[model samples]
Target: MAYCPKCKGEMPQTAAQCPHCQFDFPVESPTGEGARTGFAYSPLADFALLVSMIAATIGSVSTAIGSIVAVFHGHFFEGLFIGPIAFFLQLGMLVTFLRVTKLGEEKQ
Candidate 1:
């Protein structure tokens, strides 16, 4: 599936025009700048994606290490607490990233 670049409306991948907004798809060039294979360019979206990815990586690593260390050091109860905390942390980051993408689509 593909989305209309102008209105972000869902459509068929082979669609030449958006059925909802009647927006025409641009011709495919060698560079594919207007290709239907991906999301349209948005500076804010790019930055948010990069930052969120980095944060998620670091946060996950630390959370894992911290949880393991706590359990091994006789802090089993603390390890239990850390599990849910880390889960929420990751969930929040995911939500934030999704929100940014939605905003980017809306502003495009």
Candidate 2:
């Protein structure tokens, strides 16, 4: 599904014009490029999200690696006990972030 920018009405993706507003879908703008699609997009927000996801992924992997190393190095208490816990917590947070962000945008 797609949305009409004019009326913010829900419409079929193949719609040529908004049924509610009768706004014709632009085939070419004065700039000679086709109309842009979708709404509520922000480049800065996207970039920030990209950076955050990358960092979170790195952190999660490092925790797992650290845990394995600690156990092999005879630090079984910290490696087995603390490493898995920390890694799982970070992973949960990352998943939560992704879900919330996606839901928030859709509800907007």
Candidate 3:
């Protein structure tokens, strides 16, 4: 089974037009309103992007400031490891979220 690009309804693989929504899968009627195969950006991705941005900002600022303060206070060992580790973990999480979002949108 294949899914309609517009409505995401399952249809026969050989179907050219979606029976559920009557959207033509490949060809349009020259009016340009019925081209159903075009990719649409997911709203969920927008939310994810906002969340990731916030996470990154919080992580970076906290980590950097924490490390700097620790170093200035003469706690070199703790600052050298904990701060950068936290920042990098947040960065990795942001990248992974972005990649998953893009892949999900493309598959739609």
TM-score of each: 0.42, 0.51, 0.47
RMSD of each: 11.3, 10.3, 10.1
What is candidate 2's TM-score against the reference? 0.51
List residue ranges in candidate 3 displaced over 4 A: 1-53
Candidate 2, 1-108: lDDT as tens digits:
989999999988878899999989764343332332334246776677677777778888999999999999999988999998988987887897799688656755
Question: What stretches of model 2 exceed 4 Å from their correct place?
Answer: 1-51
- Across 1-108, the per-residue lDDT of candidate 3 in tens digits comes to 988989999998888899999998575354344443333335665676778877887887888889889999999876898878987888787777678767656755
- TM-score of decoy 1: 0.42
Best by lDDT: 2
Off-target runs (Cα >4 Å) in candidate 1 are: 1-49, 102-107
Q: In terms of TM-score, which candidate is strongest?
A: 2
Q: Which residue pairs of candidate 2 clash?
A: none
What would the TM-score be for candidate 3 when compared with the true structure?
0.47
